[model samples]
Target: MSAGGMGPTLDDRGARSLLRTIPVRKGPDLQWAPAEPPRRNAAMPDARTSGPTAGRKRDPLIEPRVFEAAVRVYARAGWGGFTFDAVAREAGVGKPALYRRWSGGEELLVSALHNLDFPTARDCGSVRADLLDYARQWVHWYRHPDRALAGRRISLDSRARPALAALYEEMINRPRTEAAREITRRAVARGELAPAVRSSTLPDLLVGAMSTHWESTPEGSRARLRRTFPAYAETLVDIILAGAQAMPPRP
Candidate 1:
């Protein structure tokens, strides 16, 4: 039924005539067209809706809801899986509200990682202890199964969309790297790390360990991780710690 009346009341010819009278202007279309059936942003990992502008409204997501939806998006679809529209849908709001601030899924993914609440080893006063705590926090955050799923999405999205990959590396991984570096630095200061150990390598060791751990024993993924992640993390950390001690002396 249409505003005019029951649509079936008109025959095919009459409907044709009505449609012919309607005009469509060839206005400029957006760069990205909505894909058929709209099966998530699986195509372009960077697929995003409009972003917040100068005069745009304040953030539509409140504290907990924003956090909650982000995790959902990451877990359900991964980093690339999250978009303003999806977030809006998850948050039960209009997509335009979320778009006003973030340009794409990458921005939203980065935001989620920042809110992960991983404790620093600095406060713990022992680098190794800090790492254990960091690992504990990492496990806790990822224990939800959603985090692991998000990690996988982010990894795949990184290859599909380089700009988005850069965003994740810069906004998310880099900070984690820096945090890990801080722990290594403390250990070095305490003479726990070999004199030859390079602080820069600290992040590499951790990243490698984490990547391997997540990639190998992914939870909530189509494939399960070969081994238990908790046990893996413990061993992985130990290996990195050993590698740090084995580094040839520098200067």
Candidate 2:
């Protein structure tokens, strides 16, 4: 300013302001520094990156042994005897542990029924095959001693225990009915079944027939029933499918 502007010499502040106006030059040697990664606590493990629990083996949501114990208790003592304390004693776990998983006896029974792994309806490209597969699963379930015993006990007590019956209808029967409905729906969609065919009750009829047959079979003849149930399942499916096909279309 003194030489060019013909003015008084600038103060320290004015000189600093003039320096700020200069553009910075970035050269080949000027590279951005890499940012440092966040540090992790070595003592504490992250649960998300690990399993359900960190630094501990993950536990099952409902243990198989616990489910078996619940079934055993229910089968042995019916609804009245199916208490949390009884189930815990049978399962070899504390009542608190069982409570943590299920709120009450009904919920525990529902979970046990779920653990049976009922077959879901699948698309086998043909209604006949789909029905057979579904029925076959029921045959297997009926033959299993633990599951059959539990189911028989529930069926017997359904009238006396309305709450248990409601739970069973909601959790078990509803899903099974829905699966069977899906098979009929698929058949109608493919033109194999008439749109107005009343096949909604087909699953019930099949299940009722199976249950009656099972109950009527004498204890001494259970082995024979086991051997014959597969063929019976096939015949049952065939008869239902034939009737459904022959049903007149609704007006």
Candidate 3:
């Protein structure tokens, strides 16, 4: 792997294949829908309540609820509190049900993170606009109370939990890195970015900056950060694009 684990890995091909299956929104109107309201049932609810199970017969609606519960529990308690019993209680499901789906908490947490949605790269006319849209979307998600808490908790525990570190790279980072790579690749193809640009590192640079900003900013000042994030993201993109343009042509 390259610096910051940004370069393509052995699994890049497989990751791209999986990404193709995910829906990609086009144009410039990207927006995040609010999280689903939590359900009240103690157990898995019938699928018929929402719609016909039809093609989704194999997967229960409870699975998403369990995933959400697992994230909440893990976010609040970290690795020590991420127990099956805790998740079961948070999900209002039996421990046996969780055991049936996941062998342990590590597996449950990885699956939960993987189940979280990721938006695909879009061709929004220019690299600058595309990057701004992507950055804005990410900032919005990072500001979401539940996702922000979960992300911070996971980042903190990743150093001690090898399983979490690996799973996070495979399930979360790889796909996102690939998405960023695609944006850069498209920009280069369109002559918007210099061919000499080290496109692989773009994701790491952008994502790392966002994560660091989120973690380092005092909680009291986060509201201000949220309010100004769009302008901040735009400035960040401008710097990056300018640097890419300034790089000498690749030999």
Candidate 4:
């Protein structure tokens, strides 16, 4: 308390007393002993790196919504952005559920696209009219940024991702083949054309002519044939009718 009392202030007295009782610590902790270097251990592969995927079968009970969300996610983000964890988070489900249903992203994407039914009914008054309506529906689908961007994305992935390609095939190509068969079948029924016109060829002709594009790939630019499609359908109908009328009458 007093500036220079020889008995010392309480602080000085306490410091001196503590110094006497405290043990001294020794110098620099040099405990590491130098020795010959041991052989380096090889790195272990991660559990995921070696997991089974070659022939893994998906669980049979996948929910439709999960698959749909997965496709939308992948279509917008592509493969790099997709993962079981990401999809589960987006879908409000556990990651394991998605994995159980789909071994990988491709299967989920393909299944989702397959779920989108193309509009191809047989009655638009005539096959020609039906095809035109179908073309209009396709144009509506294409004009939507969601479907266009999705279609473009899936189309690109298809080379390495066969299932996505198969999805496209099922929608675009298969329906064309089937619808053509239907059209030919109708013609036969109505006595409008020869039964021997080859049903298969009818689809080929229609699809080939209607679907011709500037780039000729799913990823390519659609031919500026929107105006031409309906026009061609009408002319095609007229030509087919004329040809049928000129042929010998059906027995």
For residue 27, what is the lDDT in candidate 4?
70
What RMSD does each model have against the real structure? Answer: 18.6, 13.0, 27.5, 18.1
TM-score of each: 0.58, 0.70, 0.67, 0.46
Q: Is candidate 1 or candidate 3 better by TM-score?
A: 3
Which portions of model 4 miss their true places by more than 4 Å? 1-64, 121-125, 152-156, 162-176, 193-251
Candidate 1, residue 55: lDDT: 51
Query: lDDT per model, in order?
Result: 0.65, 0.80, 0.76, 0.59
lDDT of 2 by residue, 175-214 (tens): 7778778888899899999887755756666777888889
**Pairs with steric clashes in candidate 1:** 51-100, 52-100, 52-101, 196-249, 217-225
In model 2, what is the error at residue 56, expressed in angstroms? 7.0
Candidate closer to the true structure by lDDT (higher is better), 2 or 3:
2
Which candidate number would show the highest lDDT if scored against the true structure? Answer: 2
Estimate, for each residue in 6-63, the C-alpha lDDT of model 4 and write its tens digit: 6555587787665555333447654433344445546854555546764446545456
Q: Quick one: ranking by TM-score, best first?
A: 2, 3, 1, 4
Which runs in model 2 stand beyond 4 Å of their true positions?
1-58, 155-166
Cα lDDT of model 1 by residue, 33-63, tens digit:
3333335655544325444433545554464
Estimate the TM-score for candidate 1: 0.58
Clashing pairs in 3: none
Report the lDDT of model 3 for residue 6: 85
Quality of model 1 by C-alpha lDDT: 0.65
Q: What clash count goes with each model?
A: 5, 0, 0, 0
lDDT tens string, model 3, 129-234? 7888788877777766576677667766877889888887787767777877888888889987778776675656776787787888898999898898878877
